[model samples]
Target chain A: MSRQQRHDARVPIALAVLGWLAVAFFVLPIMALVLRVPWSSLSDVITDDATTEALTLSVFTSVITTVLAIVLGVPLAWLLARSNIPGRQFIRALCTLSMVLPPVVAGVALLASLGRRGVVGEILDDWFGVRLPFTMPAVVIAQLFVAMPFLVLTVESGFARSAGTVEEAARTLGASPWYVFTRVTLPATQPAIVAGAVLTWARALGEFGATITFAGNFPGTTRTLPIATYLALESDIDDALLISMVMVVISVVILVALRGRWVGAIGGMR
Target chain B: MGWRNWGYEVSLSIDVKRRIGATQLNVQFTVAIGETVAIVGPNGAGKTSLLRVVAGLISADEGRISWDGMVWDDASSGEFSPPEQRPLAYVFQDYALIEHLTVGDNVAFGLRARGVRRRRARERAQEVLDVVGGSDLVERMPSSLSGGEAQTVAIARALATEPTVMLFDEPFAALDASARAHARRLFSSMRSLSMARLIVTHDAVEALTLADRIVVVESGSVVQIGTPSEVLATPRSHFVAEILGLNPLSGQLRGDELSLGAMSLTVGAHGVDDGEVIAIVRPRSVSLHRERPEGSPRNVWRTTVEAVDRSDGRVRVQLGAPLPIAVEVTPAGFDALATELDGDVWASVKASEIVVQPA
Candidate 1:
């Protein structure tokens, strides 16, 4: 073989063994779960009332959360990426903080700020006679809090990497700033936006710790797939495995649909 | 407020000073309608920065930019018009075609932005694309276009706006020789239009051929502004001379004798009384010999061969030391002395061939 091919192929035996072991560590659990799945009754288990309710709730809350994230997060991402605003770095860090924060900590932080007896929550409660905790909206809020960072960080990075010259070229062609943003900047960054939205939706779909902590586990209101899966594990392992398999299938579909864009978004984060 | 030239009036006038990092860009020039001025400079010479200021992409720190008596930017009064409001089009170095849009849509962008109906804009875009020789590319995506095709589309986009001024930054840089020639012909045809054009290019040949007037900038300042012939025959500075591929030697001058450091040459009759002067010598006028040849040439120097570059059927011999200059020779002439080219040689130039200018 060629010299480069020979050099590349000559990996140390110890490293090769460790690499395969690491691969096995990730693959083993998924294999075990797949093996335990009762294929004959899988459809019946998935269509059961509690399972369907949790699945429906997960889909509904995550979709709404994804929409809200795009509405709120895109402008914030643009501001962070393109503006000359003071304290931009600090604001960006603040916006992306939840991405790295533990899910339970994010939930607690959300509760501390929006809980009935807490900071803005007390004012919201007294002024509007509204209680946010243990509600369906609370589930969405928790999911948004934990998941919006993925969208914001992804779109912001896309904006950072896109060429500013195209926008300038548009401006020189008599396009207003708003027109340039809508026609040029937005379209250029569409891949990042789509990738980020999918990532946010997936994160919201799989949310467990934050929903349980802040939103509480109610079958029709706050309980999502992960919450239902956790509760099912206490009584029925097969039902829990079915729910896990559903989530895995959805995740795989999203990854397959995203392909290179998802990998690019993840790489951009690093 | 405007200078009259023939029948048309000067439209764009700029006298600006801007400090970009360490370079202090102080430039002042005017582009009359139907006139094409080329900004020629080395890298980091603020040619692009000057274009940016004129296009209103960047504001000048001092002085005023006015077009047809309307103030575009006046740093003293803090009045500035952004790029969108300027009656101009900028062809960027990379063409900057929108990747998401079809070629037609890219060209139609300026018209659509100006509130033209979509149908009308598309019609106009097609018309302009036809004008720029890219009508066939109208339906194709910008990503699918070749370099020349992209350049044509960019020019079409700019033309769709019917702008009064055109700013181009190395517009032909991405094209191959044949494409560049095509683009040049396109530009020449467009010269019949009344719009003023300011093009920034590092290529001397491009500047000489394309520009009605050449503005040579060095270290963020205009060193010379003249017609191509005026600039070519008598370049003011060593930088300009070097850019024009001529050798410039600065010396003390009195009558016919010019003292170049310890060496001196008998320069032909230059009417201007001079103290310090620069003498420009064309590379082709310089002849290299094995020994000092018996000739009427007034100047002869022993020069070491520093480098030999061959291109376009000619050889350029770079001489080093006491006198550093370049001498051009034919391929056959070069072949005769090919073996001895690495060593020292005698270079001689006639007095009449040297152009003298006040330093």
Candidate 2:
């Protein structure tokens, strides 16, 4: 064999070893859970009424939360990435603070600000007869608070990578600011938006502490799969395992579909 | 449709100040109907900055940009039109083709932005693409295009807009030699048909070939403005001479002696003086004779061949020793001088052809 050929052959094998190590690290716990799960009780656990309700609520709230995040987060990402407004850096930092905060801490902060006895909550209850805590809205708000940052961060980075010259060209071509943004800038940044949306939806699906604390984990309203899994873990291991497996399967399916797209989107930008 | 003969009349005076940057583009120039103006300068000489100011991409702190008797930007009067409102199109150096869009779509982008209907915009875009020889690649994305193809698409897209004025920022810089040659030919053909073009390029060949008048800018100022022949015959600044590839040799010409720094060479012509004089000499004018003839036309120097470079169809030989002279010769001259090493060679130049300018 040629000297150069022997050097080139080792690269793929070395990369393959690292890839296997990452896979093993992420999959070992899931593998253990599936192996220990009683196949006989799996059908019974799936048939549980509370489990079905929790699964339905999980999907519903996660979808709603992701939608809300998109509506607010896309504009915020655009502003953070493109604008030279005052205190923009501070606002961007504040948006991503939720990503670093513990879910319980985030729930506490939300409760203090919007609970019935809390500052705005007292006024909302007295003036408008509105109670935000222990509601489905609270679950969505909690999920959005944590997951929206993922979307904003991902999309903002995409915006940062995109050439501003294209936008300038559009403007020179007689496009108004709004037209340039909507037709040119938005389409260019679509892949970033999609990847960010997927990440946010995944994060929303896995939310637990904030939702359980602020929304009170009601079966038909806010008791999502992660909450139900935790509650089931207290009393029944088989049900918890099954619920966990279901969450994993759903997340894995969505992730597998989206991973290729995310890679493709980023690669296209380069 | 053919462009209207709207003779360019813009009285522009710009003064801008920012935190870490400032640009002062204060100059007034006019172009005749269908005239092509070339802004020649190095990067960051405020050439692009001036174009931006005129196009209304950036408003000057204190300036008035009145094009064709219409005020695009008048800071004192608080009149500033956005880039979109201005009837101008710019071809960026990078081509700036929308990567996600097809060539046809990109060309159509400008028309659509101007509120043109979809069908009409596409038809116009197709017409332009045909002119630029890019009709076959209309459906192709920007990623698939070669450099020349992409540049043609960019120009086609710009031309499709049919604006009153077209600004190009080194449009041929990214293209290869053949592509640049083709682009020059394309511009020459479109000169009579298109609107007034303002091309910003450092290439002398591009300027001389495509521009009707050249505006030489350096250090945030317009150094010289003239036709290609005028600028070539007489360059105002060292920058202009360097850019045009003319060797601006400074020397004192007194009586029959020309003092070039420490060295003094005797010339045939005697009427010249001391203090601040530039000698403009073309490389092709200097001859490398085998020996110094008894009677010859003008200045002579015995020098060695420093370096040799082949360009276009000619060979340029760099002379060594007391004075470094770049001399261009044909293939035959090169072949004759090929065997000659780094030894002595007699160099002679005509006295009349050597243009002298004030320092």
Candidate 3:
């Protein structure tokens, strides 16, 4: 064996200890929730009308948010990937701004634009008599605002990678521009699109600070899983832990299914 | 290789000026209907750029490209039809078949783009796949196919649109020798089906064997256009000669004596007097010896062998010394010479083998 290989197996003791503690630091919360399941009344806590209402609202809002993200994000991804519009850099920066900003800040920004008596919101109230905040649709908007950049950025990179000579070849074969995009570009980037969708869905399901701040957490309307967990924490700690366990389980299952490569793809896309 | 365009009329005329990065392409060429032209050039010689412009992927700065009396691009009139409106098909080197699509669907992409119904498109795709003799691959995904299979699917896809003109850029460069040979045999059958074909390749043998007319491009310009035999027998430039495995030496020529490097080579009579000239020696005429010949000197030079490349069942030895020259030899002949890489050897050429061109 080489001299380097002989010494490579030994690691510093303090590093080993600290590394174990780091794993425990992130993993212990889920362990705590699992240990504190309160198995006796688990059914009561899980099937309560309020719990079901919040769970249904979470599913509905997150699903709509994901659909909305795909609808708006794919075209945005295409435009950013393929077109040479003026000020595209600025536009891309704006699209990705939510990814780096705190979720609460995105909530405030959305409120400022779409809330009653807030900039465009005030104009919207005056001109069209529309009040967006504290509505079911506002719940979707809050989740979408914080989650869209994941989809857009991931799919944009996919578009960039696929927008090459194939698209040109498709065009040369008498494919209309729209046909080329749908037939060649979209199919080529399908893996990235699916990966982006999974990320968007996961992010939307966990949206809390934004939904609470902008959508105003009503039990059946805007109290998504994260917001419901937060509310239960203040009133009933066991109930909160149960909701936390549920969130943890779902996130774990989804993320475990995706494993490393796809998450790395999304992270790299970001 | 033997197809003739004698009675056919010119269908595609490209006289365009384009600038790609620092290299500007100012080229003029035409291909008659039923004529397949092979564009051979070094890398970055704007061969692909010329094809792209002709295929309508890029517009010219100022010129006209018309096919079948319809102007595809006329910069003077500010008129340019985008690629989808043009009746042409381009197959890129990478094949560009969609992995998500079955071979059948990939081939049907163009028909769908033209608003054909699903059943009709699939049937048409099958028909074209049959034309390429790849109907068995119809249900297969592009991911499952080999490089050769993907290329056949790409061609089937291109032909599904029934385009009048087809442009291929290094279509066989990605394949192994056997696959390339198979693809070549399949592609030669296309000569009877295609109205016009322009292929960009750096392989001289491919250019010689596949094209009815060969256009030699260098520095983004058309340097020569002739039959394959004409270009192979009389390559115009050092680049073309080197690519075609011809020994090209540029030097000063006075009367019948040509000064090449430190050695003077005797040549047949040439009309050029006391000026720079390029002398070509066919590789077959170049003889190699393990040691100096008994004679004092002729066109013999002691050189070192650099590399040996075998193609088309013939071995070519690259010799580097006073000049780097490619010499063709049979495998048996090379074995008889017993040459090793970087070993010293003597090369001799006959005066009758040299052809002089005014430089």
Candidate 4:
């Protein structure tokens, strides 16, 4: 055989074995959950009042969270990527801290800041007679807290990676700054934005620690799919397995649907 | 559109100084309506930067840019208009077409940005694309376009804006040879428009053929600015001469006889009064010989070949001392003479081949 052909065919046994082991480590749990699903009672478990409430709540809250993230996170991403704001690095780190922070810690931080006697929460309570804890808004806030950083970081990298020459050309062609941002910059970074939104939605759908800690698990109000799965683990393991399988299916479908954009975003970041 | 009177007024005037990286760019020039000026220089000579300053993409550190009696930028006053505030269009080197939009939408973008109706903007885009010979490219995506097609679409996009001033930064640099020729003809037709135009290019042929006046820049400074023929016949700096590929020798002119240091050559008829002059010689006109021969040529000199460079089917023999000049010869001609590097060779040029101009 040619030397190059032999070299191309050769695989390091240690690296190949370790890589396969890593793949098996991730795949085996999902395979076990799929196997453990009670096939005859799957429909019955899914249609149960607790499962329906949790699924409906999770879908609605995650959708709102994704939309809110796009609305608020996109502009912040643009500022971080393109503006000369003072202490921009510090601001970016603060915004994305939740991405790496332990979820339970994020829940504690949110509670401290937004609880009844908390800093902003006391003012909100006195001024408007409103309480945020143990509410639907609180669930959304909890999801947004942990989920938005994925979107902000992804779209920020997109904004930074896209060349400014096209925007400059648009300006010279008489496009106003707002028009350029809307028609040119946003559209040019759409792939990353879409990938980021999907990631944010998925993260919100799967939220557990933050929602249970800050929002306090409440049926049909704050308890989302992940919380339902955890609660079912205490009473009925079969129901927990079914809910887990549903989440896995939904996540797999979404990721597969947007595989191209997700892969492109990762490549662009690199 | 029939503003045909040349040199009527200076429609655009710029006197700007700025520091760009390690290069301090100081340039001043004026362009009248219906005038097309080509800026020519080597890489990093600030040609593109000069265009950017005028386009309002980059503000100069000092001085003023005024067009049609209106100030666009004044550093002392701290008054600078952003690019969108200027009635200008810039065709970038890479076309910079919006990849997400169809070619029609890309061309229509400027009009839409200016608050034109969508239907009207699309119609205008179609008309402009037809004018630039890109009607068939309207539905195609920018990503699907070839380099030439994208360049044409970019031109159409710029033209659709109907701008008062146009800036082109190496517009043809990305095109193939045939496409470059086509684009040159297209740009030549555009010169008749009544708006001021500035084109940045390193192509000598483009500068000479397309510009009413050529501005030669070197190390971020304006070295020379004149008509193409004037600049070509009397290059003021070695950079300009090298760019135009001509050998310029300073000499004293007495009647038709020009003295080149210790040597003298009879030059062609120049009607100017006798004084210090510069003579331009084309390298292709200088012939190399193995031995001095009896000839009708008026100028002959013995020089040693300093270097032999062969590229693109032609050989350039760099002759050393007495007159340090380069002679371009065909490979067949060079092979016939049997000249080697560092070998002594006699060079001769006809008297009429020399162009004499005022120093």
Model 4 ranges off by over 4 Å: A1-3, B1-10, B243-359
Number of the top candidate by TM-score? Answer: 4
Per-residue lDDT tens digits of candidate 4, residues B102-149?
A: 999999999999999999999999999998888899999999999989
Which consecutive 10 residues in model 2 chain A have the weakest lDDT in total? A261-270
TM-score for each candidate, following the candidate numbering:
0.83, 0.78, 0.81, 0.84
TM-score winner between candidates 3 and 4: 4
Ordered from best to worst TM-score, the candidate numbers read 4, 1, 3, 2
For all candidates in order, the CA lDDT equals 0.87, 0.80, 0.84, 0.88
lDDT tens readout by residue for model 3, A4-109: 9879987899999999999999989778778987777789988999888998899888999999999999999888877999998899999988888898888888
Candidate 4 lDDT (Cα, 0 to 1): 0.88
Per-residue lDDT of model 2, residues B1-359, tens digit only: 22223543442323442111564565556654478899887776788877777677777666576656667888788898899988788888888999999999999999999899999999999999999888899899999998889889988988888887888999778876456645755676677864677889886656665688999877667889998779988989976765456566778877655678856655433223455555656777788877785687457778898888876788878888777878788978878754456967888877644644335
TM-score of chain A of 3: 0.91
List the candidates ranked by DockQ, beginning with the highest. 1, 4, 2, 3
Better of 2 and 3 by lDDT: 3
C-alpha lDDT (0 to 100) for residue B159 of candidate 4? 93
Taking the tens digit of each residue's C-alpha lDDT, what string does model 1 give over A1-270?
899999998989999999999999999998988999888789898879999999999999999999999999999999988899999989988988888889999889888989988799999999998889889999999999989998998998888878578999999999999999999998888899999999999999999888898999999999999999999999998898988999989988998999878668646552
List residue ranges in candidate 2 displaced over 4 A: A1-25, A260-270, B1-26, B243-359
Residue B151 Cα positional deviation in candidate 1, in Å, after optimal superposition: 1.3
Q: Give me the runs in candidate 3 sitting further than 4 Å from their true place.
A: A1-14, A267-270, B1-10, B243-359
lDDT of 3 at A11: 83
Weakest lDDT window of 10 consecutive positions for candidate 1 chain B = B1-10
